[model samples]
Target: MALLYIIIIVAFIDTFSQLPIIAPFAISLGATPMLVGIIIGLYSFSNIIGNIVSGYWIDRSGPKIVLCVGMIFVGIVLFFYSIVTTPQQLVYVRFFHGLAGGLIVPAAFTYLGSRKTSESKGRIMAFSGASVGIAAIAGPALGAIISGRFGYDYLFFMLTVLMIGCAVLAIFFVKELQVISSKAASPQITSLKLTKPMLFSYTSIFLLMFTLGILTFALPLKVEELQLSAELTGPLLSVFGLVAILIFVLPTNVLFDKWNNVHLMTIGLVIICGALVSLSLSASFIHLLLAMMIYGGGFAFIFPSTSATVVEHSGEAKRGKAFGLFYACFSFGVITGSFFAGALAVSPSFLFLIGALCLLLIVILLYLFSWKPVI
Candidate 1:
């Protein structure tokens, strides 16, 4: 279990450290606008593929093996990143990188879901999420420093080293899931019959990532609009992840356990709309800071709870595919949200206003439809 924690932390840090460099590096290689988009976006496309396949594979191959193989594969691909001489080659490399890395979440969550009781799933999920939050906060900053000091190639090499450490932890410490010998008791994984709650959980994932992806696209422009130092965006950006971590680290774990997940998610949606509305109207650093912090709180609330909902609502054999779909929604959300923000961002405030209104509409629909589940 502790090994799982270490693996999650190291894997996330390694994965995220590569984020900020992708587009700039592609552009540096004379990649055109569309090709650059392909270079950057192809990773998530391949990731969606990875998520869907790994769901089936996780059950057949085993989580420990799948996770280790995925980690090692991505680590190895990072080495290839250093040697790419053309945008096409980098594109090929990133495509595979996404495939390999995508194995982690579905497999890890499935493995955890099988092992942890419903009562305790909240704590474990929150712990894992907090690790991710810390990594997200550190990854871009660390990526910049490492790339600056040594070069982008060297940074990839360092991530490879960390990934190798993750694989080692997986091999030496992570326990394999216990297999059920009674085949009759093990229900066959049917067609992906998504239910109402599961469907909502997936949508919740998409919405969560939409907020994050658009923030990346829109927040920097907002910072520039306010005439603040570009450096201030770092703290502004970090507050979201930091607040999520704080909420998870605090007693909200009880709410995650005791509350209706759908209700928690609805509250989170409302708060995120507030964050976006604040960003849409922000005229100063303090205003943006408040919005970012609010966004963080909302993110903290939704992520773990919805994740638990997806897993909790799934049957054992169906869990892999369920989580696969859940994460794929996340990837799709990010991809679309980023493109949406990029396209509509001639006026950053207006872009955020549009995003906020879209979310408000969703909240209204959810309330009206009851999503059939809860508040």
Candidate 2:
């Protein structure tokens, strides 16, 4: 479990490290605003492929080996990123990096879900969620400092080390379980199967993450448009991440335990809609901060609820595939959101309004389907 926390932190840090440096890095590389958007969007484009393939492999081979390979792959990619001089080269690196990142979430979640009980599942997942929060809180600040002082190469080097460390931990500490078929299961093991409930859970994750990607791309541009200093942007983003973690690890989990997962998800979507509306009106730091807090809180609730639902709905044999599909949805949403936001860059306000409308559409779908809570 401790090892899992290490892996989570490393993954979170590696993934977010570029957030603080992206704009400045792009400027240094002579990328225009549109080009910068493309560079950022490209990472998500790669993630779509990685999530599906990695999920399938983990389901077939177990998470331990898949995780190890993913960590190693990311580490090598980070090293390569240090040398990227063109937008095209950076795009290629980000695409492969996203593919590597696609493996980590499902593999980790599937491993946790495959355990014997939901109570333990919740505990481990809470810890994993907290680790992500901590990383989100710390990563951008660290990246900003490193980039401001030693430049992008040093930041990438630091990420490479963290990725390598994650690989080492996985190799030494992660224990692999034998892949057992339903027919060969011991009496203590319950046979599980994938169902429609699992598909809905994955759909929920995909929709939420898709909106999140759009927000990520749009928010930075909005901040820049407001003429805020580059340093201020990192701290502002950290505020959102911090609020998200705090809400996710405690209040949101309690809510999940007390309420139906479907109901909680609906409420979360509503909150996101409100946040987007608020973001559209935001013209200052305070307004952005308020909007982000609400947005982050919504994200906090939706993420774990959706994940827990996937676990609850899937059978033991198909847990890996379910999680893999879940992650695939998440990655695909991100890719779609990024690409869509980039293409629609002419009006950030309109983009946010569209996101809100999409959430409303999702809420209507959920209501119409009368989706039952998985947990």
Candidate 3:
């Protein structure tokens, strides 16, 4: 279990590390703003494929193999990042990278979900979110520092080594569970079904990460506009993670179990909307930091809630597919947000405002549709 968390952390670290550098790296390769956005989005777009496919594989073969192979493929892709010279090549790299990465989280989450009892699901998932929060804290700062001091190539090489090492750890230390089988599970094909809880969970995750995509796409540009060095982007992002991690580990985490997931999601979305609006209005570094803190609070609320909802609703046999589809929504949201931000070529303020509105729309629909399920 500890090793599983470590793998999750490393996989996410590989992701968040690129947040600060991705824009600048593409620009260095002569990518236009639009092209940079496409380059960023293409990864998530292809990741949808990987996420869906991985579910079937995880159900059949088990998560250990998926994690190990995914890590190796991702490491190989990161190595290509060091050698790519053109934005087009970077696009190819990001697409494959997203695909490779798409395999990992579903595998880890499915592993956890299969084993977790109902009473412990929310708390345990909060810990999983905390692992992600830790990565969010470390990844950006390390990315900026390494890229700032040693250059992006070296940073990519370092990530490649770290991923490969984690893969080795997965192979040796990660335990393989006996894959649970039932009449429903023995068939290789698991029919993907959409239920109310799944719908709520999927919608919430999409909106949450969609806003994040916009933020990630816009933040570096926002820093540049404010005449701040790109290094500041790391700390700004870290603030969000720091706040989120506190909420995840502190006593507040218990709310995930005690509270109604939909109600909690509504409250969280309201906070996130406010935070996004505040982000659009931010004028200084301190203001940006405060907005990110608010965003993190909202994030901590929703992440555990939605993840627990998925586990609580889905049966063990279909858990892999449920998570796979759940994360596919995750990738799709990022793709839409990135493309929208880039294609519009709007001010960061406008992008943030749009994100706020989108989230507000979801919140409204949630209430109107009775997002809560009947027992």
Candidate 4:
């Protein structure tokens, strides 16, 4: 459990550590606003590719090995980030970083979700979720402080050390579970049955992550455009992370245990739509705060519900493949959201409205699907 927590924290840190630095880094490289968007968007694009491939690898190799390799890759790539002097070079690094990240998370979640009992599964996942939340809150602050004090080079060095530490911890402490051999083995571990529930869960994950990508990519840029200090951006993001942690750690599980996963997920989707609408209209700090709260709540509710449902419907032997597919959906959505939102951000008002429209479309789709019985 301790090792798992370490891995989750490292993954979260790796994912978010760049948020506060991206704008400044791009400007230093002589990038225009659109180029900055491309750098950020490219990370998600590469992440999707990595998630699909790594998901398959996880099913074949098991979580422990894949996770360790992922950590090593992240550590090495991040060390190179500080030295890159061109936007194109940064884009390349971000792509590979996303690929490494793709390996770590889905494998970790697959291992946790495949535990013997649902109750235990929920608890483990909740803890993992909380770890991510804490990292989201802390990583930006750490990045801002490091960047402000020593520069981006030193920040990358620190992250490299942290990633190496996570790798060492995983190697020393995480126990690898043996794959169950069965008649199902003939099809290969990477092959799994896809059912209606799995498809629905994938859709939910895609939409959920889509919303997150929009917020993560757009909000930071918005802050920079307003010339806000990194210190202020760090705290705002921390507040967003804290709210998400609260929702993920508390009410989400109760609702999941007491009600259907579908119901919980549907409600989460509705909340996300509302949050996006709020974001579209936000013109001040207070408005952004309220939007973040709503966005965070929606995120907290949807992630665990979707994850738990995927685990519920998957067989033990196919759990890794199932989760890989799930993560693929998630990464793909994030990639799509970042790319589209980045393109749209040339005009802030248009960008927010487009994001809101996308969420509204998702809400309608959720309702349409809900009206039909789950197969």
The best candidate by TM-score is 1
Report lDDT per candidate.
0.82, 0.76, 0.86, 0.76
lDDT (Cα, tens digit) per residue for candidate 2, span 1-375: 667777878887887778768777877878888888777766766776777777678756888888889889989998997898887787788788888887777787777777664464444555566787788888877887898899889999989988888898789888896675646765334344445455556677777777877887888777878887656666666776788777766644666666676766777778889998888889898998899888877777677677778777776666777777777787778777777787774767778988888878877886556555556
- Per-candidate TM equals 0.94, 0.87, 0.89, 0.86
* lDDT (C-alpha) at residue 298 in model 1: 88
- How many clashes in each structure? 0, 2, 0, 0
Q: Which runs of model 4 end up more than 4 angstroms from their true locations?
A: 26-35, 85-88, 182-191, 217-234, 282-284, 345-354, 370-375
Higher-lDDT candidate of 3 and 4 = 3
- Angstrom error of the Cα, residue 298, model 4: value is 1.2
- In candidate 3, residue 347 scores what lDDT? 89
Q: The CA-based lDDT of model 3 is what?
A: 0.86
- Using alpha carbons, what is the TM-score of model 4? 0.86
Could you give the C-alpha RMSD of every candidate to the true structure, in order shown? 2.4, 3.5, 3.1, 3.3
